[model samples]
Target chain A: AQSVAQPEDQVNVAEGNPLTVKCTYSVSGNPYLFWYVQYPNRGLQFLLKYITGDNLVKGSYGFEAEFNKSQTSFHLKKPSALVSDSALYFCAVTPGTYKYIFGTGTRLKVLA
Target chain B: DAGVTQSPTHLIKTRGQHVTLRCSPISGHKSVSWYQQVLGQGPQFIFQYYEKEERGRGNFPDRFSARQFPNYSSELNVNALLLGDSALYLCASSASRQAFSYEQYFGPGTRLTVT
Candidate 1:
């Protein structure tokens, strides 16, 4: 079965500092990876995805993720973090199927 | 353009009762999927419909059911709801089911609380 793992339960970073949310996956064949952010009482908003080419994929809200094939990882990163960027982050993987396997999620707290 | 829309932003029900949740996919979107998001957990896939047909279903029980209309709108029905059913229900839509890398647009979600 395909699965996604987000090792960190929460990550704390200072404002204006670089941040990384780690994600790893186990899936057969090629993997379609995605990152989504969720605010309190709000549905998830798409951040970025790795479909085909381009190991580094840029997305909305100044977020980007790098797809590392050898490491089997797709880590979300931002050059500088903002207090408003604090939220729940989820990593999902799809095997070109209708269902998406999601990780437990990691809470990112950007300290100001 | 409007994003995916779900009706009744919040709902409260008791165990053994039935609840119906509605969702309308984005304009021209042909696929709709439902997910259950428990507090502090990532969303779990419930069902997926395309062209008014069931495309996929998750590991949920038979009490959980859903359908897609000709206009691509959808409704999720849970019979004999249990307290465990309390969670946020999310609806997502995509251009088509055939697109392997299709991105899904999500609605604000309906918060369901079962007592």
Candidate 2:
């Protein structure tokens, strides 16, 4: 039963400020993590993924995530947030099972 | 190349009725997956089809079924729909079944509302 947990339901940050969205996972084997962003009335867009090797993975839209194996966490971060960055963020974990378990999702609100 | 596409961007159905959602995978993509996303919740896996065959199924009931055509297009059929079934139906496509780690291109999704 591999699962992902996104503790926050919503995160508010001012524009130009650094932002972080927390994510943690539980899996039996090696975990392949991913981050996706969904805009209003649009499909999900892939941001980044962590399969192996690097613990710090960079993604699109200046997003990056750190995969902590011992802590079972992969947190999404950005150096500076923008108003356009407001969207729904989802963290997912795949254990090479061809199926992904997604977190509940965290709504990011970037104020200008 | 165009990304994944879904037909009928919006659909409304009544209780106990049946609805079919269609999805066209990206060009050259061989794997298609279906998901149900309720308002304010993350997408839930429904089914996965590859090479015109069923590769995986979620915990959904038998009332929900799906199939993939030779062209890599797929359809999800739900019978006796309930209000709880009202959600956005999402379709995602990948190059291969083994390429699970790769990013999946998602369609705009079909908003299904069960009254």
Residue clash pairs of candidate 2 = none
Kindly list the interface RMSD, in angstroms, of each predicted candidate in the order they appear: 1.3, 0.9
TM-scores, one per candidate:
0.97, 0.98
Model 1, B1-115: lDDT tens digits are 9999999899999999999999999999999999999987889999999999999999999999999988999999999999999999999999988534888889999999999
Please tell me which predicted candidate would have the highest TM-score against the true structure. Answer: 2
Mark the regions of model 2 whose C-alpha exceeds 4 Å error after superposition: none
In candidate 2, what are the lDDT values of residues B1-115, reduced to their tens digit?
8899999999999999999999999999999999999998999999999999999988999999999999999999999999999999999999978746888889999999999
Candidate 1 CAPRI-style tier: medium
State the displacement of the C-alpha of residue A75, model 1, in Å, after optimal TM-score superposition.
0.4
Alpha carbon lDDT at B55, candidate 2: 94
Poorest 10 consecutive residues of model 1 chain A by lDDT? A39-48
* Candidate 2: tens digits of C-alpha lDDT, residues A3-106: 89999999999999999999999999899999999999999999999999989999998999999999999999999999999999999998887787899999
> For this target, which candidate reaches the highest DockQ against the unseen true structure?
2
